[model samples]
Target chain A: MSPADRFARLPDLLAADSDLQRRGRWVTVDCRVDVGDQPFFLALENGALAAFERGTRLMRSSAFTVGATDEAWTQHWQPVPAPGWHDLFALTKRGVASMEGDFRPLLQNLQFFKDLLALPRRLPERI
Target chain B: MAPVLDPMIGRYLRLQIDGVDHRVYFEEAGRGIPLVCLHTAGADGRQYRHLLADPAVTSRFRVLAFDMPWHGKSTPPDGWEKSEYRLTTASYTAAIRAFCKAMELDKPVVMGCSIGGRIVLNLAIAHAAEFRALIALEAADFQQPWYDTAWLHRPDVHGGEACAALVSGLIAPQSPPVSRHETLWMYMQGGPGVFKGDLYFYRVDGDLREKVKSIDTKVCPLYLLTGEYDFSCTSEDTLRTAAQIPGVEVQIMKHVGHFPMSEHPAKFREYILPILEKIS
Candidate 1:
């Protein structure tokens, strides 16, 4: 899938997840996901997704950034990621993924971020 | 304010335990019966810092807290990489036995929290005659379904940050900001792979459901205390485990989580003093 196409599907996938909505109910944070060179930003308000945009430049403030190489992103989006690709932290720990900026929000709402990122994993492989 | 009673701080000692030289860091305070304290997973002897400094508790008993091998100020044994720094029950038990023996602590009251808490049960069951009593905080027979270490154990996963984030959730919501930060800081400083190694003992290799019944209360009376907000080892989980072991006493601390001694020492002390009175 094209980067834009993949980014466009995140909002719908996030919205449809009842567990994510419920667990993220109290969370409100701006998160950026950088897949290879393609960057996407998501704004979560009160545990619900508020906005999503595809761009390299972070126009607005962001709480944290989760970035990874194309190969790493591909493996992470797999139905069942291999050992090192299974978690964002795992990817970061393995030196394949990079996380920067404030960590409080990501740590505080860890489950939400974990579930949110895993959404693409649940998507059909073709998409 | 009451004058603080100074604890007898001991220097870090390099002791030969389980046949390898291990740098065991420990501290001691107070005067009477020995109370050997164990720390949580990924953490060190500092978890019991408040206990060692508390005047009320120390005056009545000599409190000792030591870093497990490869944790805090303690160094892992030679050729530790062979095991990838994993903590097995056999290794944990051997260390505890060696620590007690080296200190010449005669039948000390063994008190531990989390991983420390879980090991006291093993100590009581396997070597009951060595301890005068056992005080286990936030301990359970098993922690399946509630916690998972698969992601943390991934070779690429940075065990320190991942484990710190994972444990941060288990802290009580009402814990003081300073207490919470300090508790998280302790986990952050843990050696790489050490936390996952310890969890191997806590979550996997430390299954004691069948073995607990063999614990002779007469040899070492058991007291179980769990924090109200410790989701990993909930009060209900501890209570359930307590029920299976005859003569096991149980209490649940309010406004505390997994790291009771570090997260809320005053409240933890309130719960502990009463138990000590009965046991000591």
Candidate 2:
């Protein structure tokens, strides 16, 4: 019922999204999504989501890390989020979220990654 | 079979801009006051297809939309591969003026979106007397650096796909799927590096904050319309720009985004039709 929970379901959601698979067919990366104090790590292989888990040990590496407050993530997942919170770059520009690490993988697979993260919007509003 | 024909007519004109001959493609429909529509950056005039086909719009205003050189059906001038394409304020304004002169459009009402939107302000500042009025959509005098544009035309990335993906979020989710995809399709078809070249004017050379203050809206009425859903050119940005110029009209369109005319033409019409009527 939270953005973290939704993050956990991404593997399943992505496994079923054929269009996203095609879009990310060449993308392979290990990334981290930090929602406030919580961190969700994702492993994407080719077009499929290889693994998604919470918590990472010290010195663990990720291609990129997208960090924002849990509230930011929640608002971003709203069916129709407010203007500033509606997009990744928008959030970054507003200083609400931060993108760190190599940008090549993210930029090359921008639509897929953007859509992948936004998959949680389908959840009920009350959640 | 019932043969169907669209009112819109497409044509090419040989124009000499800055003493260089360039072939430009334009589409038009209707008659009366000339309403020149400028497409968004990285896109062609096809963005106004709906406006060109709409009888309501075509009946009163002669709507014309043209693709800038190196965009859509318009071909870049000779020896294009030898030089990097960078759309500067000076070159962009000259192209618009040259197109108008070549077409013999007399004091036409010019409407532009995004980069096209920003150029109208420049046009107003430099050549206000040459235009009847100017309508700017999703525009502002200055924009904070959002992202590096180099990724747009890099050999490592599919420039067209990257460009399309990056801007996809700028469209409001409420827009119809067909219209939204149609808008992105144009970005996907943009010439390699052309989108980034256009952004050079948008992000760098096109800051008009100090100069926008010089615009006398009385000489040529300026109407600015920004979509509520557009983060690229937020309504706040337009309001800030409007606040700089006295007597300039500003409207914040709801449920619309960057590509108003293309992404959601039907909804866009609700906002534009009234403005056109007001102009008439």
- Top candidate (TM-score): 2
Best model per lDDT: 2
TM-score for chain B considered on its own, for each of the candidates: 0.93, 0.99
Docking class of 1: incorrect
How well does candidate 2 score on lDDT at residue B269? 95
Where is model 2 more than 4 Å wrong at Cα? Answer: none
Looking at model 1 chain B, report the run of 10 residues with the lowest lDDT sum: B144-153
- Look at candidate 1 and give me any clashing residue pairs: A24-A47
Q: Write the per-residue lDDT of candidate 1 for residues A1-107, one digit (tens) a residue.
A: 85346656888887788877987887888888887887888888987778888876636778899888888878877775554455565566557888788866775
Pick out the ten consecutive residues of candidate 1 chain A with the lowest summed lDDT. Answer: A80-89
Write one digit per residue (lDDT tens) for candidate 2, span B172-224: 87899999999999999999999999999999899998999999988999999
Q: Cα lDDT for residue B221, model 1?
A: 92
TM-score of each: 0.70, 0.98
Q: DockQ each candidate and list the results.
A: 0.05, 0.74
